[model samples]
Target: MHEFSIAQALVEQIEAAATKEHAKRVVRVVITVGALSGVDPEALRSLFPLVAEDTVTADAELVVEPVSARVRCRACGREEAAETSFLRCSVCGSRDVELIAGRELHIKTVELEIDER
Candidate 1:
């Protein structure tokens, strides 16, 4: 699935960062995921270990912060969470809305274990 590929890329990035920091291992990885990003967090979670196998992030914890889809209504000047299936303004019921959030998938932080020895 696409999750496997995504997880692979994520592990690669984490590994690179950890190596750059001279980390002994990775402790945790925090990522932000949006509802409209078309990514299944559970699937990604399940496949992360497989992709991170033998890497610094092998035992790292993956924390996914979920972000709800939000939109701003141009007609009513209101901002609120938008329905995933329909992108309409909740207040004015107008289709003329601008997406303010949701559609994000990025690494927020990475905790690492560095060795002085």
Candidate 2:
């Protein structure tokens, strides 16, 4: 599954960050996943530990924040939540809508453990 690869990439990024900060270990990784991002949260969670087996994030907790799809209507200038299967505006019922959110796939925060000398 592509989630495995995504998990691997995530672990790599965490490792890089941890190295840069000279962290002893990664405590948590918070990521935002959009509804339209085509990523399965459960799959990613299941594969994360496998990908992080030998990395600094081996024991890191993966926290996923799900973002709902939102769109702005071009006809009525109304903004509202939308379903992935439907791109129409809720208020104006216009098909001409611009996606405002719910396509994100990025790390929001990284909690790390550092050794103090």
lDDT of 1: 0.93
- Steric clash pairs (candidate 2): none
Candidate 1 C-alpha lDDT tens digits along 13-101: 99989989999899999999999998999999999998888988999999999999999998998999988889999777999999999
Return the clash pairs for model 1, or none.
Answer: none
Separately for all candidates shown, the number of backbone clashes (residues 3 or more apart, or on different chains) is: 0, 0
Q: Candidate 2's error at 76, in angstroms?
A: 1.3
**Root-mean-square deviation of each candidate, in angstroms?**
1.2, 0.8
TM-scores, each model vs. reference: 0.94, 0.96
Residue 32 accuracy (lDDT) in model 1: 96
**In candidate 1, residue 17 scores what lDDT?**
97
